[model samples]
Target: MKYLAVLILLVTACKSPTNKKMEPKTYLDIHNEAIVIDTHNDILMKTEDQGVIFDQDLTGQTHSDLERWKTGGLDVQIFSVYCDGNTKNSYAIANRQMDSLDAVVARNPDKIVKVANSKALLKAVEAHKIAAMFGVEGGHMIEGDLNKLEALYNRGARYLSLTHNAAPDWATSAADETTNPDLEEKGLTDFGIQVIKKMNALGMMIDVSHSGEQTFWDVIKLTNKPIIASHSSVYNLASSQRNLKDDQIKAIAKNGGVIMVNFHPNFIDNSFKAKAQAFFERHATEGDSLVKSGMDTWYMQDYLYKKYADEANQIRPPLATLINHIDYIVKLVGIDYVGLGSDFDGINITPQQLDDVTDYPLITKALVERGYSEADIIKILGTNFLRVLDANEIK
Candidate 1:
């Protein structure tokens, strides 16, 4: 009996814990070891406008700084130079934002390197430096001039997302399709197609994140290289116009492109739209007043957002929902064509539990828990994006 009791104790000791085996290293350890890349981040604007310093540690916000990104194990980050479409001086705004990013890289030469190609990205990683890349967030920033596109590209812009809320006359936004019948036939104008081809020739990535469905299809038909939806989620999950529909997801994969999931609350939760609508309604009159006063919608949005942030949290979706979108895209497109484009600093509210760039490891941990093989997870984290970058690099 004594020997049997001793044997039972030994068996119990040998049994694994109830939880699956996970290393004691914090999520950062896992995240750092991987070549983690976030395809979209709006921290450049935050750093420039809000005086946030990328080289310093961030205390309150979820957006990234160089130190935080390094701590989170982020190897590459494409800083989005986002200017609201309403700005008359969109090109100037874009330039200023780019300059801001340049300044950050200059200040932190030891920590970050501005990279334009796969070789630079790889070199930066080998040197343990953060690869800093640029992406223009809206096509409108080019102000209808293809020359401006070349100039932006020359100035280190690596990708251009085709349009924001206001679609060009030849394209219908997903938001306006329900009310605008004229947009039905308008996908890409001859000029738009020319612009896409120009991008292909220049080796600048064509980002279809905020484009109308017709525009998306048109670009797919025109571009010879892989494209990306820099910061979008699955429409089936959130029912947002900003999210990709099932057909769009499949099409992106078929084109040898990638879809980087967005972490905005409205993009992750279907039910949050009503709350957003109500929030906008309550501030509608004030918003119009601010617009009349010559304040851009982005400024007015920040103002009104502060008033509603607390209430907004009550309806914010869980971070798990963002993962669900990632999972959906992976299942539909396979693991090789998905990545993350967390719209940090650009978004007013994020999903719960994802407060900022520092929270990236949570995703790595979650992906592991979801039965993703480490190899597959690494691809989703950044390799897929690097592959597209390599394929699209201009000679």
Candidate 2:
């Protein structure tokens, strides 16, 4: 048996994969060669808040930073320009977030390139630079003006999600449906349809991640190009409003859109929200006191998680759970319609082993161990998003 093991090792010789050799490739080789893309990240929002400088090391502070993106083998990133529903002057906040990204790129021009379309994105990849693009996370940022949408496109935004957790007047959100079930005209309005058409014309992908069922169906019915659930998970596993239902996943596959699985534990694990809810309840008095003192709820949650890191880690799903969501999507659809969209800095809790942006290659290693061929791994990592981007970029 020992001689057989020696013979096996001697036969393979640890060579890289090739046509003639048919030798197994290392996970690092596959990951480095692949055009790794993450379609949803919130580091720009963190930068906007002056929470961390992206060009510097953000270890133990934020999930992403420029140097670490390279360390992580990230080739492309769609920086989400986001604002909550209650934000006053939402458009300005979105623009400010964009400005912060602009500043980061300006300071680190050699490392990152802000790309507007698929062509430019590929060019950046060819130049060995991280392609930075924009994704407006909420429709409310446009302020019901198609011109603002156009402005966002001109500023390098590649997608416009119809809603966030808080739906605007023109469109409903999943949270809206959950809270106001009896409301009439809950779907996309006439103006919302116009916005969709305008996005199509501008070559911006219609993102369905945060939308309600009506809005999702509306985009499927109206958009001329492929849609993207830029960052979401499977509802069957997690049952969160942020996760997609099976029918929605099927609809996206049928429409040739991609469902980029989100890595947020609340959206990835079925028991996460409940356990987290109870944990927060135990600290409700402190949380309420913090909130009353003007601390953001999200910030308070992060603080609590850090304070209870061990318990938090116990509740977080294993890294395999993230892969399981990807596997589920692949089983339901084909390999072409699923991708990675780790919410990273945007997420409160990531599954164990996915500590920061630097952990992306672990996904490649996991996929390889699961028997996904290199070509399939490449498409899942980034080409799926590129296919949709190219399909939308046909202007």
Candidate 3:
């Protein structure tokens, strides 16, 4: 009887509630456990244009580096392959950017790997390596050729924004559609519809971040698969042409798509552009000189931002403003449709607290303070984008 009582006590102790796995009690704990994915980053462009070494510690010079990505807990990154509309040999330039990414992965074999589908993405994440993917930022890179589009997909490009700030022959951009009154075409042309169908067929996600209102609607109507706004903010929050309107947000949600919020200050703060116009105007001559000296205008702008850090920092919005954009989307469509897509290395400035990739943990902390549960925070960090990626995969 004494031995039987002792054995029963031992069994009860082994099955105690304390033996269960503990929940993540703090922000870092929660953040480290989640599969954080940033759907849009332009570091490959930076590497190709500036000849900057991405594997080194690029603090203060660039927003991202290979080591810093791991430090920030970023598990997946869709590196943007981009060239402005006017560049000659745009498709070749896009391939050159892809080559740069390939070299990056080649050098850091253990730390990162290129992924073309959801299966490989999850595998890389599980192995504690960053799953790098390609996102062609302009359809103009395809140059109105479907073969070129297929070639990009074959090279591991998973998403392609229909336009940049400038319109392609097949699709109109928000910047041109809104500002170019004399422009004859306002949306996707017949060829643009064909592009959408081809992307759907190839399992490549169609991105509408830079697309005009008409182009966005055309894609929403035509695509049988879910789409992604790779890097854009809320139109109601900031009123930027680059941001998505309320109806667009609703449409995306209804279509089971995801709008990964952009981190550009101008896209997050309503009055940011007006406030920064004078500063940019002051630097316009220097900018033009840099352009004449053969530097691209986008790089020239980023250079100015780096040069006038103190002055530029003055116009950046608070971190809460960015969180407000996320909260707005969550309130409108619930937590399943929104995620992070920091246009790091693409934008010149971020919100005040979000200085670089390392600051991602701050977002998780902010979400926690705002009463978000762990599951919802995980969704916002990466699962929502993962869901869209999976849904768009070729069966």
Full-model lDDT for every candidate: 0.80, 0.86, 0.89
**Candidate 3 residue lDDT tens string, 68-171:** 99998888999999988888899999999999889889999999999988777777776778998999999999998999999999999999999999768899
Lowest lDDT sum, 10 consecutive residues, model 3, at 10-19
Better of 1 and 2 by lDDT: 2
Better of 2 and 3 by lDDT: 3
Q: Which candidate achieves the best lDDT against the true structure?
A: 3
Better of 1 and 2 by TM-score: 2
Provide the clashing-pair count of each candidate structure.
1, 0, 0
Cα lDDT tens digits for candidate 2, 82-174: 878778898898888898888889998898989877667767776778999999999999998999999999999999989999878899999
From the highest TM-score down, the ranking of the candidates is 2, 3, 1
Off by over 4 Å in 2: 1-23
Q: Candidate 2, after superposition: displacement of residue 146 in Å?
A: 0.5
| Rank order (by lDDT, best first) | 3, 2, 1
Model 1, 302-353: lDDT tens digits are 6677566777667678878889998998888799899989988788777877
Candidate 1 residue spans exceeding 4 A from truth: 1-28, 47-51, 169-171, 181-185, 277-311
Most TM-score-accurate candidate:
2
TM-scores for all predictions? 0.86, 0.93, 0.92
